[model samples]
Target: MTPRIHGGTDALGPARWDFSSNANACGPCPLALQAVQQADATRYPDPSYTRLRAALADLHGVEAARVLPAASASEAIQRLTAWRARAGDRRVWTPPHAYGDYAHAASAWGLERVAGPALAQLVWLCDPGSPLGQGESGAAVQAALEGDARTGVLDCAYAPLRLRGASALDPAQRDCVWQLWSPNKALGLTGVRAAYAIAPRGSEAAVAALQALAPSWPIGAHGQALLLAWAQPAVQDWVAASRTTLAAWAQDLRALLARHGWACAPSDTAFGCARPPRPLDATALRARGVKLRDATSFGLQGWWRLSAQQPPALAALDEALQEQEREAVR
Candidate 1:
């Protein structure tokens, strides 16, 4: 039998195509690259983050007082958890198959944690929830907060595909008012650790009080300057171009997989989860150079999450799937 030519499927070795994380496969903003390169390495990055905070504040539709920058989005969310889980309330809530760091951050606070639907104090949603890549509507998000309102954290870490409303989670439903946004997801600055979390308007004291618990500077002067440059209109176009290319390719790749025996779905963002038509596990397929993330990690076991952001990935995926089909039939 001929090898299937699924788009972006890694039929290579471990991390064959890095379908696990959602970092951009396209490229980083040249302006960001230049900024990092031109950074004064000897000088200490201003932890004050005056410029960074201001930039993020404008995007968030809040005062610079309402915004604070931490080392990573993890730092932001974790510190927020530490603040809320103070006293006797030591618990953080997350959806089943959420990011491990969310739980890790909560645990650092010595707080109790739970996953899957709940009315708990701390609730974490991917905005567009993950493994499925579907975003929850803003109203529904508000409802979740109002249901309890203790400390809500919107993990829009994946929302760059379509972006979110500036004030989508305003007024703090559970009196919860923290939103996590990682610039690395859309900007491909993964190693830079460029990430942030926004608190409500009156959360200034909470932010200041929680500062000691927060992590130090993440991206440094290099990352800081780069992020600002990326915020420009020209760089924004680069992001848009990448999105359009990936979106069209994703649709085509999904269609290609369906045409064969593989069952899959097109992702709303760059990631999509689907099962192979054959009786093969994601791990077993790895031996064939098709290492994909086991959906089990995302609470979607028996399936795999594949990234189709590059030109060569689709052909690789198709080839891998075809091979799998032949082996299964035999």
Candidate 2:
């Protein structure tokens, strides 16, 4: 089996100044944090996750039966892929640059990648896509809606944390596809694994298929608490406020990188891809307590994905780049 590539704190343990993962830089949200800290681990969560699912449904203004909970977005992706594979769907379509787990899960289920949304049996779309934070084209979304694909999933992991711009999909278009939400990234609780999907309006059959493939009690006590907290007004308020901070930080970080001669791609969200004026020795920088995501996995060679972080983290990165430049000159 091929290994999966991802960002965030990796096998090397956490970096002092992590620019790898695109999780909210201003979090973990205090309210959500309290909920996680207060979670009761003494017993298992409800097998059906009735209340939890209902709360998530209410948040998205969907019917309770339309919500499908998973251990994480990756788990949701895998289960959905498995469901499509079992139904004899063999082709998958993905955006040019997207989260790796889409392709990884598709490959695991023997689904081949096909060009164009209209040609595939299963299609994946990420609005404010990963590694770039750019929204998908509205025309392409309309095309996917009109395609013959059996299932289409829109990963909304970054949607909550989107710093700017509007979604390409309108309300009706969004209802035509699976909308996956992993609030952990927005809440800065990525360590807590839990995610849920809102099935397309009237997608009972698809919901049933996904539930059948999922293990019982997909979310644990902590995950339940985190998600429950996520539905609270106070938590939503916090997330909204954090975006203001992230926007400022993102602008500052971009300017800093530009001053250092890095070329950055324009982004609508808090994270983006950039290329250093010169090649960077990533491993050496990691050793210096800073880590950046190599965008190679996202198919952007010679570029790196950077999450907008606070001044301290940005300062560390600036110093590390300077050190690398000195070493290169030597």
User: Which is the leading candidate under lDDT?
Assistant: 2
**Could you tell me how far off, in angstroms, the CA of residue 324 lies in candidate 1 after the best superposition?**
2.3
TM-score of each: 0.82, 0.98
What candidate 1 gets wrong by more than 4 Å, as runs, is 1-16, 108-110, 114-118, 137-140, 147-149, 163-176, 215-219, 281-289
Task: Report lDDT per candidate.
Answer: 0.64, 0.90
Q: Lowest summed-lDDT stretch of 10 residues in model 2? A: 142-151
The residue-level lDDT of candidate 1 at 270 comes to 67
lDDT of 1 by residue, 1-330 (tens): 112222233444235555565667676656666767787888777787888788777766677776666667766666676677774566566766555666676667776765433546776767665666766555446545665345667776677665323434444441355767777667776667566667755778867876666656655776677666655667668877777776776677677767775677545676778786555655655655555666765557678776655656667767777776777778
- The best candidate by TM-score is 2
Q: Which stretches of candidate 2 lie over 4 Å from their true place?
A: 147-149
Worst window of 10 by summed lDDT in candidate 1: 1-10
